[model samples]
Target chain A: GQQVMQIPQYQHVQEGEDFTTYCNSSTTLSNIQWYKQRPGGHPVFLIQLVKSGEVKKQKRLTFQFGEAKKNSSLHITATQTTDVGTYFCAGYTGKLIFGQGTTLQVKP
Target chain B: EAGVTQSPTHLIKTRGQQVTLRCSPISGHTSVYWYQQALGLGLQFLLWYDEGEERNRGNFPPRFSGRQFPNYSSELNVNALELEDSALYLCASSDGTSDVKNIQYFGAGTRLSVL
Candidate 1:
């Protein structure tokens, strides 16, 4: 059974601060996907990483996949109130094994 | 290109009652996945349906069951619901055309409140 473990269950950051969340999987993964769920909203796909050591950036957000494909990280720069949400890392095999997620609270 | 769609934005049920949730995948998508997100908890995998077949399920009890339709839609049935069943049930879909990587597109989940 594959499981994804996320670090820092909750985080409160001041505006303009940086935030980072890490995810580690119990088994090797074929790909890793990141999602964000805003309050009262569904989980929205952010990005997907398939190659080992792959790095992708979206504006102030950066995503990285471990060389082993068993870990991933999401980093947000210059946090804003609009960035408030729970970030999830899902490992994809035939199905998805989602991490517990890291809830980010940005303080204005 | 429509995203995944789920029915009944919210639902209310009582103990010993039964509930059904419906989900329609995006056009051309053939895989549907159901997940339960309890308050302050993570998304717990409920079931996976591909090509109108029950492909896999999670650690949930037998009371939690579902089936896929011929058109790639899905219905999740929960029998003898308990108070702990109160959670947000999310339905996601992916293109099952030998892509190998499952990049899921989620729908606005149905919030089920079991009393």
Candidate 2:
């Protein structure tokens, strides 16, 4: 069985602070995807990284995939009140396996 | 184009009962996936259906089963449900093509409560 673990299950940061969540997989992944879910909402696809040691950015959010393809991280710069949500990293081997997710709370 | 659509936005059942949740993927999407999300928890993979066939399943009991229709729509059935079965059931769909990267689009999900 393959497993994906995420760190800092819960994070609370001030409005102007930066936040980062790490994800590690028990086995190498074919690809990794990031998602965000608002309170009482379903998960929404964000981005996918297929190349090793790849980094992608969307506005103030940065996503990086490890060179070994077993780890990934998502960093949000200068968090805003609208950024409050649960961030999840999913790894794909034969099928998709989701991490427990990191809930981010941005204080205004 | 519409996103994935799930039925009966909410359901309430008691222990030992059976429940069925339905999902219609976005047109032209051939893969449907089921996941369970408990209160304050992450998404747990349940089942995957493609081309009206059972493709892959998670570590769930036989009590959890499902099927895909010719239209690529799917139904998830849970029999002999227990209190622990209460959770939000999310249905997602992806284009099962070689060129596509298998990015899943999710439905609003069906909230199930078993007493």
Each candidate's lDDT (Cα)?
0.93, 0.94
Looking at chain B only, the TM-scores across the models are: 0.96, 0.96
Q: How close is candidate 1 to the true structure, as a TM-score?
A: 0.97
lDDT of 1 by residue, B1-115 (tens): 8889999999999999999999999998999999999987889999999998888999999999999999999999999999999999999998873425478899999999988
Candidate 2 local lDDT, A1-108, one digit each (tens): 799999989999999999999999999998999999999999999999998999999999999999999999999999999999999999888778899999999889
DockQ of predicted candidate 1: 0.66
Query: How large an RMSD does model 1 have?
Result: 1.2
Residue B17 of candidate 1: its Cα lDDT?
Answer: 100
- Write the residue-wise lDDT of candidate 1 on A7-100 in tens digits: 9999999999999999999988888999999988889999999999999999999999999999999999999999999999998876788999
Over the true interface, candidate 1 deviates by an RMSD, in Å, of 1.9
Q: What is the lDDT of candidate 1?
A: 0.93
* Model 2 alpha-carbon miss at residue B114, Å: 1.2
